[model samples]
Target: MYAIGIDIGGTTIKVGLVDGGKIINSNRKPTASTPEEAVANIVLQIDALFEKYNLTVKDIVGIGIGCPGLISSEEGVVCHISTMKWHNFPIVSLLKKTYNTNIKVSNDANVAALGEAMFGAGEKFNNSIMLTLGTGVGGGIIIDNKIYAGAFSKGAELGHMVIRIGGEPCGCGRRGCLETYASATGLTRMTKSAMEQHPESEMWKFVDGDINKVDGRTSFECAKQGDAAANSVVDDFVMYLSEGIMNLANIFRPEAFIIGGGISAQGKYLTDKLTAYCEKYCYGYKNAPKSEIITATLGNDAGIIGAAALVI
Candidate 1:
């Protein structure tokens, strides 16, 4: 049987026809501003998929959705979504009423983790955690091949974990959250700060003195060129990132830590640094088998495949 997976993002909505861990067909559209409009647009895509494939509702098993923000997966309600400005929206109920099919909804990050565990880098392990380093740090945990969302379904807010007691301010109203230092946004901020402090650094030339052009890759690229300033930025980034990874390692001890997001594209350069740092500082490094640090394999399809796995 087949399933429909919908990955709802701040700017786009991805719909896919998935079967046996594969997305046979998919499409994308701009996200609507309102929940009603968003749901309507999704419905249009769902109908289009059915028509394009010449299939009926009976041929499909169910529909799964991965949405941003605080989601109550059991109740299928979105408690809050900062990016979409949605609160207490019963997304599953609305979709079910309109489509008359089984529906499941979950936090986008959690679903992405689930997707990875079921079909991507974590597929070989029964327990794993996925960390997506993007504009913000997103985390999801899998235990015994099942998603562990905690009692309130809000357990895995990994980025919010404080690495520094009083450092840079975070969007979550806290100080020194891991996201403030480990994400792509954090990397850019660090690179910009480094450039400001060292006008003689080559990083300024890479961005042509445009701090706005600095990105997650700037520090890494400059560091590769033997820029001391950029190397310092990368060193600090890896140190704090290792702290967070070690914390999670000691707590969950999952078989692997799957890294995703734009920064993950750095491939072995990123994984090697993370693995080295994790090994050097992770608890019981000498006596225990360390969790492998690896890159996520599914890339963008992880959300869609994972959303579909919710029903499979």
Candidate 2:
């Protein structure tokens, strides 16, 4: 049976039809302006796939969706997604009207983690943490081969984790949140700060006298090109990221730590830095799992793949 996995992101709605752990068909559409309209659009997209594959509802085992914001995955209800302009939407019921088939829904992060656990980087580990480094640091925790959705389906709010009590102000109306320093925007902020402090650093030269060019990639580029200022900013961000992960290691101690999303593409350089930094703060890394930190193998498809694999 083929399963359709859909990920509702703030900017786009991604869907995929999969079988045997591989996505054989997929498509994306701009996210709906309203919850109701969004569901309708998804149904239309699924119908297109159904026709293309020459299959009917009977051939589809299930449909799974993942979205940001608070939600009761067990209940298939969405609650207050500021980024998506959503509030109290009954996603499961809405989708049911269109398919009349079994459906599953979950927070985007959790489902993405599920995808990695079932088919991507965390497949080898029974216990794992999946981090999506994008506009912000999204995440999901899997334990005992099942997602730990917490008591209220709010298990993995990694970006909101407070690394500093009174650091940078976060859009979540909190101060010094980890997302402020560990995300893309965080890197930008750090770069600007670094430039202000070290006006003559090598990074400034690479940025072409434009602070706007000093983004995360620019910082990484400069660091790779041997820029001390950019390296310092990268080090500071990595230090904070590892510091936060240390607490995760001390508690979850998963079999593997899978870093997913765009930012994680930095590869071994990042994992090495994160590991070295985390180890310093870890209680005792000498005998710990050595925490084999690895990048996400599935990339952006983790959420969709995980959603499809939900029925597997």
> In terms of TM-score, how similar is model 2 to the real structure?
0.95
Q: Return the top candidate by TM-score.
A: 1
lDDT (0 to 1) per candidate: 0.92, 0.84
TM-score each candidate: 0.97, 0.95
Q: Over the stretch 1-312, how does candidate 1's per-residue lDDT look in tens digits?
A: 799999999989999999988999999999999999999999999999999999877889999999999999989999998877899999999998877778999889999999999999999999999999999999999999888989879889999999999988999999999999999999999989889999999999999888889999999988989999999999999898889999999999999999999989888887899899888778897688989999999999999999998888
Those runs of model 1 whose alpha carbons end farther than 4 Å from true positions after fitting are none
RMSD of each: 1.2, 1.5
The total of clashing pairs for model 1 equals: 0
Candidate 1 versus truth, CA RMSD in Å, comes to: 1.2
